[model samples]
Target: MVKDLHGKNIIITGASGGIGEKMARLCAERGANLALVARRTDKLAAMKEELEQRYSIDIYTFSLDVSNMEKVEEVFPLILERFKVIDVLVNNAGYGIFTYAHDADMKEVKSMFDVNVLGLIACTQQVLPKMLATKSGHIINIASQAGKIATPKSSTYSATKHAVLGYSNSLRMEVASQGVYITTVNPGPIETNFFDIADKEGTYVKNVQRYMLKPEYVARKVVDVMLTPTREVNLPRWMNLGSKVFAIAPRLFEWAGRGVFNKK
Candidate 1:
């Protein structure tokens, strides 16, 4: 089991807003030093200032786009130099692009993969050696319910998340003996800018807007699972059950999903 956050050095990507921002504050409350990373330097700086003022904990901010692996490699080491050690890495930088298979742009697909799959992989790779050397660390991957089930208009986005699900589990097993822990937090839907950013013309976006979950709710669940060290965590248990069952039996699930999606 992993230790509490007090005095631990933590790194959170996409820390400018949404669940990532909430996680940063929660970690501060637990007395962890944080390195907040995002593309928005102003936002990162503001959050860093607030956390330092309120919690009196060490806080560093970096304006980074995780999709750039080289930049991630360079910035991460600098963060480590500042903090001296990183005990946790939260791979929370991601976006959703909900579009039908044919309607999806290849460029958008690449962007999704770069951020959700490759970026996540690169960050974890950078941190793995340090964690393994010490034989202690925790990696929290923020995925989605779409990771397990392939919804109609969210094909590419779902694919990337699915990759996360498989990759996190495999990484967990590989590092289990070394005392490192990896957990995947799959939340169904969260009331965030996801709908605004997603392809609005897609069927998935239309459907998702109708059943939105709050980012704070999802963030809290993520924190709870991290503290407890669960292998796989899903919020709103019913959605988890329904999605998995749907994954196991696609035809029946598709029929049901269609019924629900088609309702006016």
Candidate 2:
């Protein structure tokens, strides 16, 4: 277990709001120095001021769209220049749009993959060489339970998460020989503005409102997991059990979970 986060330099993308924001606050409370990245400059600035006031550790803010590969490359160097070697990388920048595959906008589909998949890949590639050189590091990708249990109306979103899972799994093994640790967080629906757009109709959120995980709960779990590296983390154990069932018996799950799984 890693325990204390004091002075650990961590980089968290999508830190302006939602789960990313919650993770940033928690890490700061634990004494980790942070580089908060997001496109919302104003929000980032406000968050930085608040966090800096509460914690003595360094909190740097960067405003950039994670999908922009060039900007990520450029800003990341500056962050490293400021914070030195990044002890932890949190790939939490992602978005989703719920719609049937046939009716989905091609542009929206591409954006999801760009931010959720390629953006994550770009950031990881930028950090890996340094982590490998030091022989110590941790990478946490904020995936979704949608990745493990794909269903109707979220096919594209789920596809991107599946890609995250596949990449994280392979990368973890590849870097296992070194000291780098990779953890994929697969959380069920989280209470955030994400659903405002992800489910503009509000149908899914309404149906599963009771089961949605709190952002703080999810964030704390992610920060704690950094202490003890694990292959994967499926949040809110009850949801994880559903994912496990789907993994073990797909046909059975499909037959039994027709209504429940279709909630999303």
Candidate 3:
């Protein structure tokens, strides 16, 4: 068994609600201190109030838009000031949309990469130095199953997640000898506000609802991952297997799963 997370400093981005919030609560229960980052201050404050009630832990809130490199640079230092040693960093701030590549909104596409890819990288880079200094730290990246197997109507979103997966895979190996753990999460779908934004058309998320993973399930597993360092996590095991199959026999799988894969 891995050591308890008691007193470990963990920073979670996009932590105002959903999986991020649930993960914070789970980590708090494990006695971990948290730095919750999000663009919404009111939501962050509310979360802090309730989490403190149940767990005696230091909960710091930062209203941040991780996509803004300037803001990230400005605020990350304050985190270091309060929490001298960073133990874990969870890059959970990301979103996706269901739209064909040709019909995709460039604004949304750029924004996705900004937050999903660049933003995740910026946050990881911020704490990376400290982790290197200590030769001990964990970095958890929230990618997606789409990253593993690209599908129609989610081309741009899939590209962003694919970037995350590539980075995590390379980074994990780079820092392994230095004792830093990097874990990438590829979850199929979850019951969260993410669907509201991702599926504005009410298409994909609705159809995939039955196969969706729960926020709490992912949250609990994320916390468990922090305690027990691992390479990667793909939730709802069946979906993970499909990704593997797609990787092994792309043409056959795509031909057989055309409707679901091509649906708009």
Candidate 4:
């Protein structure tokens, strides 16, 4: 049976667009009050106004760059002040720049880690204490299928997601006895603006356009599992099969799937 989200305080990072925006809408539809965080304040404000009008739930918008640690520290308290407690935290704020390791720019690489890995950790820490005290809360990290099956040209981005998976796995065990839950979302290529930076040449998107998952589909899958003890949510179950195959026989899988892996 599905859990109830009515009146729950859900915090979604990177809520301006893509799956984040879609998730926000779904949560609001379920009567969940929201705290939307993103760097795009204008888009967030517009969403806030629209959702408030459409749903009878309260909505708060916070302009945040998760990569900025000090700002993360400052903003989370403000969210708590408004909502009193966070029932769910969806750490969906991250980006990637696909490039061969040798050709990768250091600046871009550092920025990716700061936002995708450290930034996620920083945000999780802020709510953990309160969640533990309350013995109830959920932390959802948006990872990638690349974390499970590494591919060419996405070395750094994949590494960050791998870190996310590792961190979430360990954290889940630590909080198992408690009421807190940790969930990681691993999705294949989705039809979103993420490729605007990850694949500027459009080669990857063009290659996988036919198989791309829709944002609404991914968002709905995520929202359905909210407040549940779902360990992981993997989109496009077929891709997840490939990940399992890669894990069991890395050498053979890489040899046979070289062409598919290099699509990026």
Using all chains and alpha carbons, the TM-scores for the candidates as numbered come to 0.93, 0.97, 0.97, 0.99
Regions of model 4 farther than 4 Å from truth: none
lDDT of residue 33 for candidate 4: 98
lDDT of 4 by residue, 56-150 (tens): 99999999999999999999999989987789999999999999999999999999999999999999998999999999999999999988988
Error of 3 at 73 (Å): 0.2
From the highest TM-score down, the ranking of the candidates is 4, 2, 3, 1
Best by TM-score: 4
| lDDT per residue as tens, model 3, 146-241 | 999888888999999999999999998898799899999988889999988888887776688788888999998888889356988888798899
Ranking of all candidate structures by their lDDT, best first: 4, 2, 3, 1
lDDT of each: 0.83, 0.91, 0.91, 0.95
Summed over model 2, clashes come to: 1
Clash number for each model: 1, 1, 0, 0
Which is the better candidate, 1 or 3, if ranked by lDDT?
3
lDDT (C-alpha) at residue 112 in model 4: 99
Best by lDDT: 4
